[model samples]
Target: MGGYLPETIVTNDDFTKMVDTSDAWIIERTGIRQRHKVAPGQRTSDLAVEAARVALAAAGRTPEDVDMVIVATTTPDMPFPSTASIVQQKLGTRPCAAFDVQAVCSGFVYALTVADGFVARGIARCVLVIGAEAMSQLLDYTDRGTCILFGDGAGAVVLEPVEGEGTSADRGILGFDLQCDGSKMDLLYVDGGVFEDSNRIGKIRMQGNQVFKHAVHKISEAAENAVIKSNLSMADVDWFIPHQANQRILNGVADKLGLDRDKVISTVAMHANTSAASIPLAWYIGVQDGRVKPGDLVLIEALGGGLTWGAAAIRL
Candidate 1:
């Protein structure tokens, strides 16, 4: 796994100058001390490319070896060509099957699930799965509720097929449980889109209370169901790496699962919510800090707009 954050950092106090919010208020409510922001010329694909390079290097592979590229991002640089395509060209990757997945914060897992299918079916030998977002690009700086809750970053992983006994003990993605409730769209959504005649992009709009309620419930249920599908239980998981949406939500999910807090990998306090990038970013941190190790059983999950939520069980 690999992760990348832009050089610019926005602290809670910085939001105080932009909106009627304070460091204490932001930290107390969202547990976000600061977040990374893209520079003026930076875009989602830029972050994705850097992250992909790091992941490819870590896997001891190169762009030429990649057979497929999947990028999960809501804030793509443009609407025409996919971000994965942009990353491919920028990285000088050979022509390959490339595209984008937009499940928002649950994107990484969604992308991972797709990559798994391709490799499992012997369609792709080396797949680069990335979750990247320039969330700041879509935020309304004046809207304290949304602006203070996001940042820009990317995380990536290389997925390749491995011989496994087809059991829960497999040292790779074992199972996944994905679900979405379009009916709950109002709970979290962007207010504008490409359909707007003004050609203006919409800012994020969220019903925080409603989202918090659903996130805690759905995330926990999805995680549990995923582990069960892997023929394993919560106790078998060595780490719980979830979307870094909110520290409260992370704790809430851990509590619901009766899982130890120490077992959870969280980066929200530092990165805020990088949307799709959160899971892999946190996973990268955990591994870097030596808190997470190879061969460990990991359960990753996330909830995002579309009321989309899912979980993946893996032995890494």
Candidate 2:
């Protein structure tokens, strides 16, 4: 996996200058110290392309080698041409299947699941799955509840078919579970959109307390389900890479899974929440620091704005 964060950094003190918040108050509540933001005129596809190039290089592949591009993002560069298409064009990849999956924060896993189906069925040979977000552009900076919890970044991974024995001992993605509860959409969502407010873009709006409660429960449940589906147990998981939503929620899910806090990869303090990008970003950090490695059993999970939640088990 390869990850990219913009050059700009936004600190908690910066929020104090814009809203009725403080460094201490923000840290005490969200455990976020700083986040990165894109420069003016930088688009989400820009981040995605940079990350994708890194991933393709790391995988020893060229743009023409990719047979499909699936971008998981809520903040698309445009409504007509999907961000995946923009990324493909920017990367100079050949004509191939390109699309976007908008399960909000659960997007990466959702896209991965979709890609798994294609590769498993021999429909695509090589696929680029990216979770990129320009979340800062969607933030209502005045709303400390939402603004402080997001950052802009992109992460990408290349998935190719790895023949296995059809067992949990498989080399690649072993199993996954995707879920959503539309009834709880109001718990976390944007206030405006193309169809909702005269084609106006909206800012993030969330009910912190309620989303926190559900995140802990739903994220844990989906993770456990994925492990079981893979014919494995939590004890078999070497690393717990949950979404970087909040430190409190991350710890809560780890506790519920009985996972050692040290085994959980967390980047929320520095990266805050990158929505769909969180898992791959955190995974990239772990790999760079020598924590995550090939053949390690990993559990991934996330909860997003659609009230969507999902998990996947893989042997990386």
Q: Output the TM-score of candidate 2.
A: 0.98
Listed in order, each prediction's TM-score against the native is: 0.99, 0.98
Each candidate's lDDT (Cα)?
0.94, 0.94
Candidate 1, residues 1-316: lDDT per residue as tens digits? 8899999999999888899999999988999999999999999999999999999999999999999999999999998699999999999989999999999999999999999999999999999999999999889998888899999999999999899898877888998999999999988898887777557788899999999989999999999999988999998989999999999999999999989999999899999999999998999899889999989999999999998999999999
For each of the candidates, the C-alpha root-mean-square deviation to the true structure, in angstroms, is 0.8, 0.9
* Per-residue lDDT over 128-240 for candidate 2, one digit per residue giving the tens place of the 0 to 100 score: 99999999988997887888999999999999998789888888888899999999999999888777987667989899999998999899899989999999999999999
Candidate 1 global lDDT: 0.94
lDDT of 1 at 48: 96
Where does model 2 exceed 4 Å of error?
none
